[model samples]
Target chain A: MKLKCPTCGREYDEPVQRCECGEPVEFKLFEGEPYIAKTVWERFYDFWPVEPAMELSLGEGDTPLVKSRIGRELGVRLYLKNETANPTWSFKDRGTFLAVSYAVKAGYGAVGTVSTGNMAASVAAYAARAGLKAKILVSESASDEKLKAVGVYGADVIRVKGDYGRLYFESLKLGEKLGVYFINSDNPFRVEGYKGIAFEIAEEITPDYVLIPTSSGGLFRGIAKGFIELRESGLIEEIPTLVAVQAEGCSPICRAFSEGKERIGRFENPKTIAKAIANPYPPSGNAVLKLLREFGWKCLSVSDEEILEAQRKLAGEGIFVQPASATGVAALEKLVEGGGIEEGAKIVSILTGSGLKTLATAGQGNARECPLEGLENCVSF
Target chain B: MKLKCPTCGREYDEPVQRCECGEPVEFKLFEGEPYIAKTVWERFYDFWPVEPAMELSLGEGDTPLVKSRIGRELGVRLYLKNETANPTWSFKDRGTFLAVSYAVKAGYGAVGTVSTGNMAASVAAYAARAGLKAKILVSESASDEKLKAVGVYGADVIRVKGDYGRLYFESLKLGEKLGVYFINSDNPFRVEGYKGIAFEIAEEITPDYVLIPTSSGGLFRGIAKGFIELRESGLIEEIPTLVAVQAEGCSPICRAFSEGKERIGRFENPKTIAKAIANPYPPSGNAVLKLLREFGWKCLSVSDEEILEAQRKLAGEGIFVQPASATGVAALEKLVEGGGIEEGAKIVSILTGSGLKTLATAGQGNARECPLEGLENCVSF
Candidate 1:
């Protein structure tokens, strides 16, 4: 049970989120073929570092890969890895489910997370299901609407008024003293859980390109590792080119990659409608930069306007995703405009969360009103 | 293809939503073992009266049956049939997917539905996916927030000012004249699509009791018929006790059943927070009443307070469903208190929709604020 740092090559047998060198650490690699079963946990048991408690599952993963009708117009065959169909209506469920299992297996009676968004709700739901107390610590400025879902799952949500950003790192130390496992965004087990996304996609189709919506960069690193593992195991002939999609308003990793910087600098005064992915200083940003450089992967950022248009296009295709989730689709349009992708090439875009989470924007001034009498007049073909 | 009247025993050669005798019409029964395949349409081809166009699917059905923790306290093993995992975040996707497939295959250029809720969003999404025009007719009083998801799917959401109740029947006739198939809530194909719920559940577990959240009687009738078909095909030895659960504020069918009425009499001025199921005059009420009598089934209603409590209870179990969906759990509690269910009996409750749809109530005055300094002081065990 040794945790290894990818940067300094430091190994520790005790539980630690980051290495002494201030870089994120992950479990040491273990080699085994994926176990075949129904649920993701069962099917990928050999790939997971910890044995997941079989009973602790809300039936997460195995999301549908819906074919996109917009592909014909974009000059490529496209499929949406619809992560919105997960239990918590987001891809975070994949990570949270696994993290909670580890916490329960380690005999932790309480767990905590520092998110007022998708991760908070996911951890709360999983923690409640696993019969563990959940302590959700969010910034003082967190929206009441966003925290509602998290509270509904019986998690004790606390709003920290000052230096809330620093609390992300401090919570781990405080949680240790309180015997509560803090599964922040880029926890090792959570990153391991995200690999299931890559595993399931490969089972469905061997895409030439996989566009992922990048936030804290944990998802990007996990997916990249998943493909690498598959190739190493002879399960896949070649790993698809993984593209990191980000919002133009706040994209530290993409900016660093485009600038040929070895490390990501903190983004300043972030302003994006895709608030879900608006991470100013992502913890795993350096790791993502390394992956992008190592794999020759492209990192692109789209404006809020493009993200909105992509959202509408997805809705037109009968897939409603949040603006942040639409970043991948928006990136595809940019690639098409620049002729970056070949015609008829199989491409997959990850739709990270459901639009239902951000319905206020979708409903804003879009509905048309009609009269009662002679309603047939309004029913024009 | 021939359509048969369940009440009058009359048959028609052409497709019709309901019989001239004022009762719903269904495709004549077909007999064969289910064709084992990936999607529900392919697997259940033998049972379908009309051949569904294979490509018309938004990954509907195949929902997970999650085991409940609260059941242990009630002395029964409970499983929540999590239909919220459907693409549209509701069970209505099943019916809409099937109905939209029929419309596309029947060469209809346009489709219409009379709804402002789950069915509306489901039809709009599926119609958009199938590349058909969707004319959604909603009542004037539908909340803008509720209709937002429906409109996002690029549907023609027209608000009708006149009598919405009469408009339901009139839309069918007008839809025919306008070359559009009007798929109101109780459409035969939609009901047939719901049969997949029963089929899937039966494949997983044969419960001693199955609780359903009844609205327009479509879902209730669908599950009943699904079990009947399974028995007819020798798939299951016996059918579970089918219980219809409804909100007490608007429980016309339940009221009628408790009073031993042959036909359901509409309840006026219905008031319930569960707007999704608050149908004052459900079109399929009579059919549901008939099933209740024929099968010696029970129909029960829970107060709004009880429904709210059930919603909270479900959230505590890591499953957050809408108020209407929680009626099944509310009914289960009532049954337990009344000594209706036997100890250790296997019971399955249907969680019809997700709580994300009604976040306003869940978010109402539940969030708490804390100070920024010394946040560790708040991290008490």
Candidate 2:
């Protein structure tokens, strides 16, 4: 495998440094269809690098893409790629599983990352499964629900007592200095695993457009790469336009896309129910901005009210997802109004984390308690 | 498939009334394996099914057996068969799928059920899938979280303005009068659907003991049948003793097993955190009692605190489950007292509902808010 500059196609042995062509290099494949040792590896087998020395896994792929009937009442063929079906109940497992396995194979004893919710839990679980020491850094104020989820995976969790905006770069440097493999949320291998989402969507049904709830841009970039690989493999004749959805509170990509700017300054004063993806300065902001420009794709942001409405619509359909995930659905409403989605377009919105992990900020669902002695009060004896 | 009386071996075409011998004819196969075609339909072919069918299904069976590391710390090999992976986020989908399929095949236009949670949602979702109307009779005081989950499937949820205990029977009589197929919680075919759980366990591993959070005896009976069928088919040589775990508040089977009673008497004033299975008068109470005696099985109960502990343990492991589902793990702790889990003995505990669906009663898992412009408070800049 080799790293290739997306801008210049110049190959490099490593992506750790700027490319010889002066552009940041990205991870590359060996130029062949990926193969799985067993079909148990699932639909993602064709999308990932399929390394022979890879201490690969079979537990986290092929999530269910359920058609959203209730969302249709709002006028769209909405489908929720139930990514919570992954091993760790979050799509982060896909990236973390691949990244951790790679890290382990690369002779790394310790792996670390900076995350908010799903990523922390995902890396922790996959790291534990791979028998590697795992470390996670998060803002101390991260939701107790997410922190508890992360800690439960037995990861060494450190809560930084400051804003997490700059912690990402700090962790990267610290990991490198400590000889630790930092599977940054946007690490090439981790993002490579994200491609499986696209492969799965294609295998299940040809989606007209994919609504990705973007935070760090790794998931969106991965989905785009997955489609490119598909077209490269002749699996699909056309690529679906990927729409990256974000909270209006912290949407650098949306701002850049709207202003027709090639780069996004760090967003200030981020706010929303979607604390999961409230990264004011997304790591893959440039990469995703490039994707939108390269594909002529559009970006959309949903208000807090709209996100809440989307969450309610999803729960009404029996899918309780957190705010960040609901952003994709919320953006669909915008797309419909803007005439961005055709009447017949098949749309899929990714639901990122399980709702159980974030009830405090999203508002708790109704709770009714009647003592057992009072059972007859609601029935006939 | 033929229904035969367990006592006389007489067959009955319909499960209505009693057998020709005048005993309540349990739906036993008079001859061969009843039929898989009547249960999972074709989706049965996707996942590993014991005896999958050709036709007839409302999309039941094939729940994801998530590889969650929940409770790996108790030196326990924990595997959550996330029955919540079902469409309705509960294991009840297995049974309701079968019962409702038969109901539709029997030409019923509407389906009715009496459940405080899972079964209600399962029947409603499957009914929607099958294009049949569904009427769910639940306690007015049933957790609003559960009611919303069930009601969202487009089922007509009737919160009887009276006693919940009576609603169970009331729905049945009302369904009969309206020609609605009452998919009783423990209906024989519903039990048939539950057999899939055992099939899944066998697919995963031969558990030394399968811990079931028992309610109306259907889940318990189905698991036992799976093991028994596997043994009969020469697929396995020995059957593991099934363990029934019940909430201390409503443990009629546990009470009977402890008392060595040939039959179960009604349990009164049942109360516990595990509301899904806290049944004071389970319809299959006697049948479960008989199985316990015939198989030398055992029953155990856990307090609300124990269930809460189990729930927290599982959440840490990344599998958020309801208190009812956690009861089995709670009982397992007691069984593992003094650190004794029968060396090399595999124990499989069924987690029946998504903790996200019942967040009202769950530990809440620590969800803190970013506090509007309070981002700086939670993050490091």
Candidate 3:
């Protein structure tokens, strides 16, 4: 397998995130039918570019594609790819698990990632499970409470006090020199692993639409590539209409697409409650934008209020997802209202992470206090 | 299936927790091969006393049984039933899903549960999903922040200021009057739901021992009965030695078992970091005691310190479980030290809930601060 630059078309035999032209690269598609088997790994063994260190898996994939009640309400048969059930409570585990596996196989002593949220926790956990030293570099602004989950995995968490923007690139250079594999957002192997999500969803249902919550855009691109490869392999007849959903506050990809720009520019001062998907200048924005144009698929952004309402609606369906994960649901509602999606269309919204991690956003509707003496008065149907 | 009293041999067709003899009753063993099908519900349909209202399911069962790395360090082949993967992030989802199903099928417009922890959240989520109003009666001492997940599910959370002990019984009686089926901790249907755990474990690997973190002891009795019914059905020849693990600070069942007492007494002034399992007066204590004696199974206690250490150890293995869930591991170490467990014995510990729910207990182990300029100094093997 080879890594090929999307823009420059430069090819590298070795794993590389970006080409010399400063364009993000991806694996040259693995052309083969999925291995017919029980488990996700066995079924998709030949599809991955590198052989996964399967022994290190925390039962990450094959999350339930539950049918949503909201689908009926929206006049579309909706399914939620419940990715919160992943080991580290996020979709990042699918990527991190594969990245850590490659790091272990290459005899790398340590792995590092620049993240304070889901990715950091994912890298820390999978690395710990694989018995590899993990250095999780986070911005100084990250709260101690938020870092607790990452630190608990016994990873070497370093609070880098400066512009983390520079550190993302610097760490990649320094990590290679220090025998540490830096799997920052949009890493080649990480993107390869996310293909499993697309494969798994296709196996369950041939969705007419797949709405993905876009941040760094790795998830969107990976899913798109997954379907592309499946169609190429004669495993799937047609690819789903992939929709990139982003927060309006920080939607560089959506803005670039809307303006018919070839490349994306950074947004200033992103202020969204959906912090998880608030990437001002996503590393894979250009790649995601390219797919959006090539397929004539939509790149939509929803307001923070819309995301919160979507989160609430999901909670009503017995799923408590983070505000960022609800971006897809919010986008679906918009598409329904605008008649962008036809009635009876099979739609799926990816719920990326669990709300347990963000309980503060669950709202402050305190329990009604009922005095012991007159508690009977409060006990009404 | 009939509800049979364990003590007086009285039987009833209607759903009931206790017999007229004031002893906890259980579903009489259903004699039939498990429904051979894809999902756990279909596979174990015959085992369930009541036909489940399948429409209310939120993909609760079929949790992964992961092999533990700590098992190797402890010289035992150990498996962890990762119940944290449940819909609501706890094993309580298994029982709550069943209890809520029963409530919905019984034509109850509303359901109530007395809990401030995992059960409250599980019941609230399932009830909402089942389209039934949920009345969660939590103690006045319960924090609002902790109830956010439950509240988000649209449950009517009522903080009752009174003796919680008396309220538990009163709510059951009052709930029936108000057409609200109260599913307090040891509800018979809830116990029946827990049988799935044992059935699942047996389906994967037959072990020499199965450790469960005991709170109200419903989980313990349910698992015990599961194995008993399986054996009666000729599904297995040997039943694993069931171990009831509890926090040392509040272990009424452990105290009684250690003293060879027939009944358990209330443990006063209970204190433990594993507050989720620190039940001073577990309602199903006598029932659990009877099973322990009947099967010659073990009942043990571990200190809060041990639980924390075990929790930390699990984190190292990439499983972030709550302190209470770590009780099984803590007890295993003690049993291994005391030469109670034989070498090469296959053991399974139930990691009941996710550590994400109790992030406070994960402690404040802050990361090492690194200045941006000399970050290369921090990049060491």
Candidate 4:
């Protein structure tokens, strides 16, 4: 499997997570005909760097490309790739399933990840499924309630008390030394796994644009590569305009892109209800920036209010997602108003995770109280 | 649209929620060839009583039937019908979607349900999608945190302060009077919707036995009808032995079945960690009991401890589910020990809902603290 650093143009014959220049590495574009299979792993059989452990799959990919009513209101055909239907109720399961397969095949006895939310739970569950130990390293500020979902999978969750930014790189270094395959946000295999989303979306419809909620930029890069591969394989005529969306509260990548900067600087005091996508200093920020500049793609950020509004709107459409997942929809209105997207363009928004994970911040429903005797009147308009 | 009461053998020409005798009504056996379609609603097109609103679908049903490792330990081949992968992260979405479709077609401006958990969320979501106002009548004791998931779907959540049991029947009566279709547990269309699970399972493997986590008995009855219809349609030779699993804390149906009683009595002060299946007086209790007796099926109840153990075991297999969802797995061991199931028998257990729905009761994960400097040692064996 040939790997190359998008930012530095350095190449490696062996699978590597990052380049010597500290940029995330990615697999070379794979060109192959699609196969008739139930799972995306088998359908895009030649795309993956390693054989996906089918027995270890939790039905991660092949989520429904649900047609949305929101698109009609905006004069565009909108479809939501509902990733929340995944095993762990998040898009992370796709990457986790693939990365864990590689870890198992590579003779790693354990797998590790530096995440407190989706990735941590995903790795823990997959590691348990593979009969391998898992060392989940979380930031000191990670809540116990949030960690409960991860811990239930029997992973050894260690809350490292130090700079959360340093924990990502430190865990990788320590994991390699300890023989623990750390599949962090932008791990090469993890990014490759995300290609399934793009593949699945293409299977349903050829879109003019695809909006992705970006954090560490693994998902953006993976989807970009997926479409790129599909085009190279003569499957699709052209790659859709990929839009990288971020929470305005913590949008380093968008800030850098807007300022026309090649490199991204860390955004200080990152805070947002969309905590899942609130990365101040994304590890693959430069890699994503390069892709955006090269392809003339877009990077936009949505306000917390807009994100919440989108979350409610999606809930109205019968798909409730986390605030982070709603960013794409949140950015849709702005994109339309700004004339960045055409009126009749077919658009696909990737909903990244389940809203149940962030119940505390999800605004309360207008629940009225009624005595049983008065229930008839209470329910009446 | 023929409906029949299983208990009283009374038939209705028009669609009705329940018989005059107070038993849940179900659609008569539909004999038709399965069609090639993406969604189960279309695949089983000939079976449904009303036209399924395809535009209003939330991509429910057709969940993965994952092969399980736990079955190996029990000397049985196990498959988990992961209903948690449904739109609302529960099997209720299947029933809710179908019932909501009927409600919309029948020109009901509003739909309602009596549930505080999965069903409430499912109904609210589908109602929102169908553009029908939803009145989710939850119990007074229902947690605010749990209601957030349902409320997010823009449903009017009504916390009725009275006997939760009576609210079910009351909602139906009030809903009809107010032109609000209440798709309560065991609504004819809702039950028919659950047939998709059975159809999907049969498509994969003709299991020797199917384990259902029984609560209100709607799911069990629906699945039973699916298999029976499949057999009648000559799709399968025979129906699999259906087992209704329940928590010891609130097992009215099991208690009645074990006592050889025709009717089930209300379980006094029902309490269990598996709140999802804590229906003390299941609306379809008599119906499920009759199915068990007629088919020579089994009804087993496991303790809270066993349910928790099974939940952990499933999590270990990378499928974390709620306590109610784990009941089938929990009952597997007891069924094997009692010779209720044969050696190497193909067993399919229904994982009814997502674990995130009941995180408060979900046991905590063991998280250890480690400083950044000591992270390596902490991660080391």
Candidate 5:
């Protein structure tokens, strides 16, 4: 499979996670007709760099594209691509499944990832499914409660006591030496796997814009490539305007984009309730910045207040997602208020993970107490 | 709109939660061919009692029936009907969606349910989607942490300080008087909604046996009706043998069945890690017992140790589920050892809910610590 660096435009024949210039590499655009199949992987059979291990699949992709009532209030036709319905209750499973498939095929006995939340659990689960050893490297600050989900999958979780950013690059170097396939965020195959989200969204409706909650910029880049491939394959006539959303606390890409900077600098002391998307120095920030500038795409950052408000709003509509997942909706409100998006335009927001993962951050439900004898009085309200 | 009591054989022309005899009522057998449609609600259109609210759907049901490697060791072909993939990460969403649809159509402004776990969350989510106020009556012992998932859906959660068992009946009585439709466990429409699981399973593979993790017995009864209707519709030649699996700590239905009793007695001090299936006096226990006797089906109860072991085993297969969801797998092992099931018999185990919901009891992951500078040595093993 041919992979090319979006930022440096360097091509590589073999599968490589990043370029010599230290930028994430992605597979070249794939052009092929869609086929009738049960899963998105099979439907877009011609797109993936490696054969997806169907037996190892935990029903990751093909999540429900739920129509939202909030859309009417916002003067837009909104649809939520509920990725929380995935196996591990996150969008990471899509990438994990594809990357694990490649790892298994390439004769790697183990798979590794540097994440404490969704990706760690995803890789561990997939590795267990594929009967591969998994070394999950998490930051020292990662909570034991958060690691419980990952540990249950029988992965060897290691809390690396050092700079978290350096650990990402260090794990990759160590994994390669130890024959552990490191499928970190923006891994070439992992990014390719995310194309399924775009493919599934297109299958339902052709929207004017798609809002994605960006962290390490892997998900945004993957979706962009997916739509680009679909357009090249003659699947869709026009590409939707892609919007990269980030928390105001840690928005390196948005800051760089708005400042007209080609390269992104690390944001110091990143802190937000949306911990899943709170990456200070995203590995693929340059690649995402290049895509945004080249395509005239937008990058917006939402405040914690706005994110929590959006999360509550989504919950009101029956889909409760993590604070990070709510950033898309938060950004949508800003875009509509500024008239950046036309009225009645079709829009799709990507909900990246399940809210259950971050229960501590989810605001209380205002539960009331009642005695059984006084139930009648309680029921009256 | 025909309803019949499975135990008493009493008939009702209008929709009712239960019979005058205090047994859970169910819809009469619907005989119609499956149609080509997108959702299970549409595909099995002829099966449901009320027209499903398509616009209010959060994409519940039609979960993946994953083929398992555990079967190879058991000398039986095993498949896991992953209901954890449902909208609320549990099978309750299927029933909640259908019941809420009926509630909305019947013009009920509010809906309520008596549950502290999956059902509470499911009802709250659907009620929010249907624009109906939800009164989730949870027990006094229900943790606020657990309720956060339910409360996030903007439901009015009430911790009723009284006998948890009596609250179920009280809610229904109060709900009807206050124009609040209480879709509790075994609500006719809720049970009817579960038919989608059977329909989806049949579509994938016609198993020789189906294992259900039984608690309130609504799920078991719903599945039984689905298979029986499929057989009556001439869709399948034979109905698979249905097995109701329960934890030894609280197995009223199994205890009654084993004793050859006509009715189930309340299990005292019911305690188990599988809290989701710890219903001491299942509302539909008598109904499920009757089905077991009529069909000569099996009712097995496993220990807490076995359930935890099964949960670990499932996690090893990359499908981490709650303790209650693992009971089916635990029972499968027991049945295999006892030669209760034939060799190479096809078995489908229902994984009822997500493990993330019960993280407190999920046990700890063995996470080791390593410095980032020495990460190369940590990953070597």
Candidate 6:
């Protein structure tokens, strides 16, 4: 496989860090199979040309395609691929697992990431499982609750004092010098693993559109790539219109999309309950913008209130998702309110992470109790 | 199939309610394939059972049973049948689905319950799904979080002002007058649904032992009966040992077992972080107590700190479980620590519900973030 620059159509022998055209390169997919091949260790196997050591996987390709009853109430054919049910509790596991495998095989001494939710947890766990050192960069504002969550994985958590946005980029520079392969934010290999989610989605039902919560745009890129591979493989006739949902408080993609611009500028004053999708400036912004333009895709944004409402709606239906995860549903709601999405349009929303990872944002719990002796004061429902 | 009470030999015409003998009648495992009819309404071909007209299904059954990489760390093959992964995020859905089905079939306009965690969410959601009303009773002190969780399910959240313990029995009396079907703590029919978890476990692997978090004891009893049914069908040679785990603060079963008694007297002060298992007086206590003696099973009580540690361990492995759900792991630690669980024992620990449902207990959401402009003053993690 070779790398192609979206800007100038320049190709490279290896998946290059940057194209001769001065644009970032991505793997070019001719065709993809639903079947597993030589383990990830086999660069011998046909896979994306993302440069990394091949880490072996246990066929984490096929996740379940759940037909949710809750989606019916929301007026859509809602399907949850249940990425949280993965080896780790979020879709990042898909990317992290693959990235870690490659990084390990590439002989990286340590694996690292900048996150506290699903990605941090996922990277720490997979690195632990693979017997590699894990260095996680988290924000000082990251909750103790989430800290304990990642801490349990035995990863060396580094709580930095600075803008999380800057910390993300800083980690890569620091990690490169420290021999810790940052398997996250913009690792092209991580995007490759995300393709599995799309493959799984394509397997069950072809939808008119697929909504993905966009953070650093790795998942959006991966899912789009997965569908592309499926189409090239002749498995599916056409790609689902991929929509990227960004938090309104931090919507560089939406801003770029609205302006019909080819590139995304950094977002400032980003704020939203969907923290996972609250990237002020995603590194894959240009790559994502190109893909969106190529396919006539839409980028949408939603408010914190809408995200919370969606979260409540999903929880009402018994699927608790973090605020960021609710972005897909929130975008759907925006489409509904704007009358953009046609009724009965077959839509698939990716609940990227479980709400359990961010229970704090929901506020202090309301579980109540009375003294055992206070039984008589009970009232009617 | 008919149920015969072991103490009085009294039989029941229908398995929906308790036996006239006053013993919660157990299912008589008949000679047949361990099959329960589904109510998918044409889409439902294979299922557990639903009495005609009782089509209470929210796509609750047929949960996934995935093997655990975390278990390998302990030198034992472990599988987590995430009942917590259900619609209401608990195995209680298995039983609630059935109970609500029967309630709907019996021409009940509303179903009711007094619950802290899974049951409240399950009954509320399934009730809504079944086109029936859910009236959930809880003490004023019930965590505002859980109330909101069940409240999101659109259940009528009845905040009673009395002792939470007696609310369970009180709800039953009120249910009778209102012509509503109260899915009692140990409704015989509810137990039938819980059997589905056992069936799932049996299908995946004949586990050497099944550890269930014991509270009202409905789940423990149902699982035991499922294994019994399997044995009767000659599907398995023996039934796995049914191990029940309780929080040390409210361990009536262990207290009874320790005294070699068949019935449990209520505990006085139930102080445990595992509020779900801190049921000083569990209604199904006597029934589970009887089973423990007859089946020679063991009941272990664990401290709240231990439960929290176990919860962390599971989360470290990408599982977020309610504090109550972690009691099983806490018991496992005690079993292993006490030399009760032998090496290489293939163990299955049931994580009953999503931890997101109870984050307040963990003192989460402690950190706050500032705008990027405040980066220089950012707090250190």
Q: What are the candidates' individual DockQ scores? A: 0.36, 0.10, 0.39, 0.48, 0.48, 0.13
Superior by lDDT: candidate 5 or candidate 6: 5
For candidate 1, the per-residue lDDT at A58 reads 81
Residue A181 CA error for candidate 3 (Å)?
1.1
**lDDT string, candidate 3, B1-381, tens digits:** 689998999999999988999899999887742222366777888898777766677778788777778877778888888888888888888888888888877899999899988999999889888888989998989987778878999999999998887788889889978899999889999998889999988888888999999999989988888899999999999999999999999999999999999999999999999979988899999999999999899988999999999998888888898899999998888777767677778899998888998887788857999998889888775
Residue B63 shift from truth in candidate 1, angstroms: 1.2
C-alpha TM-score for every candidate: 0.89, 0.73, 0.89, 0.90, 0.90, 0.77
- Per-residue lDDT, model 2, residue A98, is 79
Give lDDT tens digits, candidate 5, residues B161-229. Answer: 988899888988898899999999999999999998899988877789999999999999999999999
DockQ of model 3, rounded to 2 decimals: 0.39
Q: Look at candidate 1 and give me any clashing residue pairs.
A: A161-B372, A162-B372, A372-B161
- Compared with the true structure, what per-residue lDDT tens digits does model 1 show for residues B228-319? 99999999999999999989999999999988888888789999988889988899999999888898888989999989998988888788
The predicted structure with the larger DockQ, 1 or 4, is 4
Predicted candidate 1 versus true structure: per-residue lDDT over A259-345, tens digit per residue: 999999989999999989999899899999988888888899999999999999999878889999999989987777766577788
| A272-314: candidate 2 lDDT, tens digit per residue | 8898788888889999999999998879999999998888777
> Model 3: how far is B315 from its true place, Å?
0.5
Cα lDDT of model 6 by residue, A1-381, tens digit: 788888898888875698877778888766731223332223213445554332334223344445555556557776666555444557887677678767877888788888877888778777765767777777777767776656666677766666666776666776667677888777988898887777666656788888899989999999999899878878899998898998889999889889978789988787777878888889898899999988988888889888888887766655667888888877876665666666666788888776656655655444333343543333233
lDDT of 6 by residue, B39-110 (tens): 222232233466523333444555545555555555566666676556556777778777876886678888
Q: Give candidate 4 regions above 4 Å deviation.
A: A1-37, B1-37
Off by over 4 Å in 5: A1-37, B1-37
**Residue-wise C-alpha lDDT for candidate 4, range B147-214, written one tens digit per residue:** 99999999999888988889888888898899999999999999999999999888878899899999
Lowest lDDT sum, 10 consecutive residues, model 6 chain B, at B33-42
Docking class of 2: incorrect
CA deviation > 4 Å runs, candidate 6: A1-89, A104-109, A128-132, A333-343, A356-381, B1-47, B51-76, B128-131, B304-309, B315-320, B333-343, B358-381
Angstrom error at residue A58, model 5? 1.0
Better of 2 and 4 by lDDT: 4
Ranking by lDDT: 5, 4, 3, 1, 2, 6
Better of 5 and 6 by TM-score: 5
Residue lDDT tens for model 3, A83-163: 888888899988988888888889998999989889998998888888889999989899898899899999999999898
Candidate 2 chain B, poorest ten consecutive residues by summed lDDT: B32-41
